[model samples]
Target: MEHQIDLTVEQDPSRSYRLLPEAPACGPRELTVTLRSSARDVVEIAMWSETGLLPQPRAASHHARLTIGADQIASLSARLISRWQRFVQFEPVSGSNRLREKKPYLHNANLTVRPQSELLAQVSELAREGAYLLGELLAGEERALVRFRGHLLNVLESEDLRIRFDSDLGVPWPMLAVGCERLLEGGRLTVDPFRLFLGHRHQVESTSGTYPDYWWVSDRHHAVGSANLDKDLKNVPLADDVLKLLNSRLKDLNVRHFSDKLLPDLAQPVLDEDVMYFFCHGSYEEHGGRTWHALRLSDELPIDAPLVDGYRKPHTDAAARRNSVALFHPLVVLNTCFAGAPATTGFTGLSAAFVRHGALGVLAPQIAMPQVFGAEFALRFLTCYLDEGLTAGHALLETVRWFATTYRNPLALTYGLVCGLDSRVVTSPQEGTTGS
Candidate 1:
């Protein structure tokens, strides 16, 4: 009853995997919705479920074209995105930009407009509306969507559902709402839809497919790891806590990568790391005519998408020959602002750069997070993932639930998965045969 996947990949030589213990197969009802740009203006929605559902008792999948396009759907989210800036800043944030969040503790003496509360409702409402529109979009198609809605309704209160979108539309699927109210006309949800925010209530991840590659733990001994933390923030208490967490999980934390004392070493093609974590500033820059994201590991220069790709060029020959990715697939956690948002043309950003180079997946904030909350979120997420042994998707699910219900913070709702929805840390290979 192990849920671990066996994806074999050949290295220049070899690498370590993980040990799998027996576990149960029963889990939350899950669905993967993939949206792709078909004609620049037009888009397609492909829905499928691996678990049973109503309208149909069997698992199912269906593909159909949407009359509405990505451009339109993406446009609806702009208000939420733009208005969101008032709530928090990047680098988690800096003193110059108000690093502390303003949303959680707002001046609501009159209760007229609470940014956090209102934003949550706005996002949740949009999510629900999107679901209803889907039913309308597939008006004449097979019951694929019909069954899809049925499954969504089934998980409304359970709040333990798993929904993943393999998309390029840039519509934040995690923020999209789903409910029975609109679909049923007068059926008000027993629970508030804002509480049903997909990112808050369920385990949701947005993914972008990569070039063909199989899974392989990047570490030679499953003990080596790196943390590309910014030098300036290294002394913060939470930053210390993070280093301690990594120290415990990894066999040998690469001290040089801590602040990359050399900084330029970041561009060196890496093949030995099991996990690459970044706790630094994330910013957007205009390059040529396109918007690209960059990461600051030191005061010298920024590490942008192209520079990230440069690291992998050295291994191009090997990857091409093996029909596999050149870089060893390490799990990447980007606790930086907008690290989760990908360009609609396809994923193009700091996070995507790592994903493109073969990181197991990237976990990042879709928007700028408050520094304090950002640190707390990283602590909890990494704990659930590294210590508790949950897949990245489920870990984020539990993490959001904890923050929303217990801590009452909504920023965690913005974390997105750029791939590896089902990726978990590989402890070692299963008992017997060589992981060949």
Candidate 2:
């Protein structure tokens, strides 16, 4: 005999649950009803089991008090996710008992419901199951924090465990992944509402600046460049679509497109308090009485040639020797190689040069590879940092982790780049001045 179940909330008139053809009352079985509230209001959940059209309340006054932490509840809730492997403590609760006290269970038998994938899939299952069988779920008297595993995302205020239907770019999944990984690996499980609330504010607006605080010293032609493989390497060693995705992200970051022509006005005062991004062939040069970490515009022209003459050398030893500084130490994103590698003399290449000239931090790749993955990694990593409120290091780790998971390859080797520059580099430095 099929039974019907109905759930009513006393406090929330707006919210009611309907579960039809509920399971027949086969003795007393523990029912789990998942409730996620957008606000701190006490949510009352009622579950009733019926048989033969008779209204037999399997559990009456079956209530669970949900006291949402100030940080968890948001003005506008966004869905949160967690991975199965990260299963933590869940306090089992029922209408029969108030304060269902038990030692925290780090593992859940139901975690095997889905194979471990990204954090998004795991939480969605939990939330859906809760909503699917709302009728038979018994709410306990005391509020219980059912700790599960997942990441979180929201508009600009709060994170909720809800459905994610993406017609386009609404949620930043990579950012959320980074945040969750940081919490788990660092052994920090709590969320802070105030900081999260403020961080959400930046997402609502366009991140592009009216006048970019940074500049890219790149080829003049493909100034706003595209990734093109050389003829010798033409078998499409890797997917080109990945490169396209990377470029799309770069465009969002306001990275100007350019070809291999040098822009003459690089040495001019373009440094802002923001950052500088260099995406071109970069390495150290030990020739022409000029030994420095060089950033070569992909298509180099003669310095004295009339065709392109305005690009000034960014640094002159005389200026540093004289203790004279012209621009602010901008954060340098070096999408180039040997930038952070230490030389025999214990001197690094590009990072050393940037630091010497008063740049905050330099983000660069350690090894050389095909430009496709490199560009993708750089763009995604930067997007994570600037848009997702992640520190430089966290962003790098997350980007690599995503690659490792998605491609199931040793992305950590190719794109598992490091953020060589430290955050503290920019702190002591004053605004518009090189802190040396």
The TM-score leader among the candidates is 1
Q: State TM-scores per candidate.
A: 0.74, 0.33
Clashes of each: 9, 23
How accurate locally is residue 11 in candidate 2, as Cα lDDT from 0 to 100? 67
Itemize residue pairs with steric clashes in candidate 1: 17-428, 18-427, 18-428, 18-429, 19-428, 90-93, 127-176, 127-177, 128-177
The whole-model C-alpha lDDT of candidate 2 against the native structure comes to: 0.33
Query: 1-436, model 2: which lDDT tens digit per residue?
Result: 9988797767622111111233322222112122433344643323221222213334452334444331232211222212211222334455876546441223221222323342233333333322222211222233322211110112212322111111111111221221232222354334321122111212111010011122222111111223322222223323344344435433322333332322422354433333456555545556555443444443442221111112322443444555544343445565554343222122234443444444445565433333445555555665665445354545555565555455322222222122221221111112112212
Candidate 1 regions off by >4 Å? 1-13, 17-29, 54-60, 87-158, 180-194, 217-222, 235-237, 256-270, 287-289, 323-327, 343-347, 426-436
Tell me the TM-score of model 1. 0.74
The candidate 1 region of ten consecutive residues with least summed lDDT is 105-114
Model 1 whole-model lDDT (C-alpha atoms): 0.61
Per-residue lDDT of model 1, residues 1-436, tens digit only: 8798999876644445432343224354367677788676677666657665323434345555666666666665544454445444312234587655444433211112334445445434544654554434344444654554454456544567677777765666565555535433354334544465667777776666564355553233234577877777676447778778888887767754433453444455446666677888877777566676776766657776777667665565466676655545667888877777644232266666777666767888777655666777888888887777688888888887787666555567778877666666644333123554
